[model samples]
Target: MVEIRGGAATSLDDMVFEFLEYGEESSPESSFSSGDGCYDDDRDEERSFDVEESKAFWDEQMKLLQGTFYRTNSVESKIRQATKEVLKDAAYSSQCGCGRLRVEAGGGCRSCLRREVCNRLMNLGYDCAICKSKWRSSSSIPSGEHTYLEVVHRSNEKRGELRVVIELNFRAEFEMARASEEYNRLIGNLPEIFVGKTERLRGLIKILCSAAKRCMKEKNMHLGPWRKHKYMQAKWLGTCERSAPAPLPVGNAARPAKSKASMLTFDLSEAIPIPGLRRTAVEVGVI
Candidate 1:
């Protein structure tokens, strides 16, 4: 009888003599080898299934993301149009009190941009305000605060207060320094300036957060906690403070010019005569 180490030896295999087996009949070793082939086949099938399942998941995410972006309601459209107009006008004529450009990029005045958009929306008869959302650090996410413009619409009984968020640099918020191509493609579809209802924004956050997770998985990278869904949702949806948009105080139209006499403009020869001082007129001689 053969002795097996680290495993139980089968009695049937022990009793079956190799000399008794025919050429066509399988031996114990061959049978065990065949079982290994079946196991490999099953593993291959499982791997294929996982790959297809992952592809389907990303595909569905892309579809849902595009759908959410394309769909818009009246309130959102109105606010979007108004926001565009305000930004356009500001680009041509507005400069922040801080002397920064009114663009959304770095070195640009984000507060000025928000104030301008909010005030303009209010002028359009919308209840727009600058909202500051602050949250303490939790187990999942760190403490952080976000400031953005929001419009509150009091619809009829069926629809209560509708909150539409306006993010001037919406795309930048989700941009990752190192991300998969698929994730970049998803973010590419996002608007630089986002104007959408809270519900719509919530849907977008879910889609993007899922995409981010998938992206990290594909890249075999770790996703930062701040990029998670809860953090993103808290930026706009969480409870916070809201203040009505007020026009930035206009700087003085013109500062009065200080009066000063230039020394260069004063004529020394025209000085008033001092007492006991004789005026000397010298005649020029040409040699």
Candidate 2:
């Protein structure tokens, strides 16, 4: 229902999705309507244009996604809100984790670790997204210093504007569909982001995936990649890329049960140090 525009520049995902969808629609229309074989060649040529457009869009997107963070609602707030939505969706008893609904929350497997397992498989060890979510009347899960969701918010005192990211605990850390969007799909455990990290990152990933499921479930919406905002896409694609956030090692096990991959073996063969993406001097922030 909420078509995100004007609040900020359109995201790269939005552009890519829009472009892809338009190309798909135009393909059928532009083709068969060409009539006789004489004009058919011309029509086919048009399709090549579409192909070029799509390829160009995706190639540009890869650069953006690989870049630094984009500017949107306070990164801290958006991430915090998005994360909480996912966790709240998880606490629900009605949604399912089946592959039934792509965007909306659907079934009962949300709370199951198995569902999380399957999601990891889908995301290539990234985050565990709910397969589906069921409604619940009571969602009173235990709360504590360890149990509470970690959020980073914007600091009023910061120059320009700074979002308070929930401190992505890459150490503990961690969508879908539309014929238009691109997804990192796997049939089954945590996606790429969740395979390793701290409790903070893992916790944040849990919340985001859950919210994403719910958002899609309710309205058939998709969280297009952050690169959709042309501004963000450009920022992310800037000359100086930033390093991925770090994890929270000290408090790794505060809630190990919620994270299954915590037990997996990671190949530390290359004791590579942190990336130099952050060394560049740019007005960028990471959450």
Candidate 3:
């Protein structure tokens, strides 16, 4: 005979069997008298439901947080990449004639004079001092029939850096050539004294400056605002500014001149119609 003790622990199988037996043998009125079991069952179900809801809510929150983090990271990365690419290899070059005149009366051949002027202009950081003065005087500058200046942009890519060169077309040279007598006289004179004698050189200078200004405007239009945003975001994220190397003090004799990316600023309000020339003037100083 199997003996069962009162108030003893029961196995799952035993509990199931006892529950079934009680349900069958006990009267409904008697079962109702002990309401604690029903209440406990309801409480357990409520607890399970609450736990499930809390877990689901936390899971959703985590997903949203992760998504936001990823999106921010993606935008920052893109901006940084673009900024680096735009700044990496930016340069400009011009093929404007030197304001020096060459003629038989000057005892110099046109080809020799042209070469000398070009070489001198290149040495002077590709600036014609004479041209700058002319640009200041002119209301309207001439355009070139052929492109005279080139602006280069090299962008980083997986395959390689993509290079883009913009050639500026101006009408200055063509117009000067059309006025043959004045053009010939202007070229034959020495550049030092020739500045006051000719409008051709001035017109050419104005055109060159205009071309340079346009290039800078285009560059700023494309990248300036985007780069600013990237810089701000980097500053906020604590990824760049704090960790960046300190700038060398101006008075530190031991510090080497560090080359930085050139930032072009264009001031539309200037005596010369060409904007962004102040910085250029500094680089390509007057003759």
Top TM-score hit: 1
Candidate 1: TM-score? Answer: 0.71
lDDT of 2 by residue, 1-287 (tens): 11111111322223111111111111011122446547566688777875676555445444443221221233333343344344344334332333222232322332232343333223342222221111222232221111111121235674443212122112222134442332222101122212111222323343334333433433445544431222221221112211222221222234355633432554333334565534445686888
Per-model clash counts, in order, read 0, 66, 8
- Superior by lDDT: candidate 1 or candidate 3: 1
Rank list by TM-score: 1, 2, 3
Q: TM-score of the candidate numbered 3? A: 0.17
Q: Candidate order by lDDT, highest to lowest? A: 1, 2, 3
| Root-mean-square deviation (CA) per prediction | 23.1, 25.0, 39.3
Model 1: how far residue 253 lies from native, Å = 4.7
Give the local distance difference test score of model 3. 0.26
Residue by residue across 1-287, what tens digits does model 3's lDDT show?
11211101322222111111121111000111234566677667666765566445434433432332222222223322332232121111111123223222221233333333323333434322111001111223221111111111223646332111111111222222222332233222211111111122233343333322333332333322212322222211111111111232223345567955433654444535665544444456678
TM-score of 2: 0.25
Once fitted onto the true fold, the runs of candidate 2 whose alpha carbons sit more than 4 angstroms away are: 1-39, 69-162, 166-174, 177-287
> Which 10 residues in a row give candidate 2 its minimum summed lDDT?
20-29
Q: After superposition, how far is residue 208 of candidate 3 from its true place, in Å?
A: 56
